[model samples]
Target: MPSTDDLKLRIEAAIPGSSAAVTDLTGTGDHFRATVVAPEFAELSRIEQHRRVYAVFGADIGGPIHALSLVTKAEA
Candidate 1:
């Protein structure tokens, strides 16, 4: 199970100029909710933005990480 800070770092690293706030929604370190704000999301659709963040986790999603709820926003 990945920690919230680990998830945050991975997201920020994967998406340049992005900020991620990761919460352990279930307190188990496996369920998480991430609020990601990125300049890269400015032109992308919501699905696309989610895809970008999900890509950072790759096979980890649904594996070590049980569930990840996401809220993505384009940076103003």
Candidate 2:
């Protein structure tokens, strides 16, 4: 199981100019809620921005992280 810090790193690396706040939604380490802010998300649609964030985890999304709740925003 990946730690929340690990998840935050992966997202920050994947999303341009992005930072993340991750919460463990479950004790199993398979569920999380992440608040991500990035400049790359500025022009993106909500779903598209979400997809970009989701793309970071790839297979880990459903495996090590079963559920990922994402909150994406542009860098203000």
Best by TM-score: 1
Q: List the residue pairs that clash in candidate 1.
A: none
Task: Give all candidates' CA lDDT scores.
Answer: 0.94, 0.89
Superposed model 1: Cα runs more than 4 Å off: none
Q: Estimate each model's TM-score.
A: 0.96, 0.93
lDDT of 2 by residue, 1-76 (tens): 8889999999988776899999998877888999999997889999999999899989887887899998889974
Q: RMSD for all candidates, in order, please.
A: 0.8, 1.1
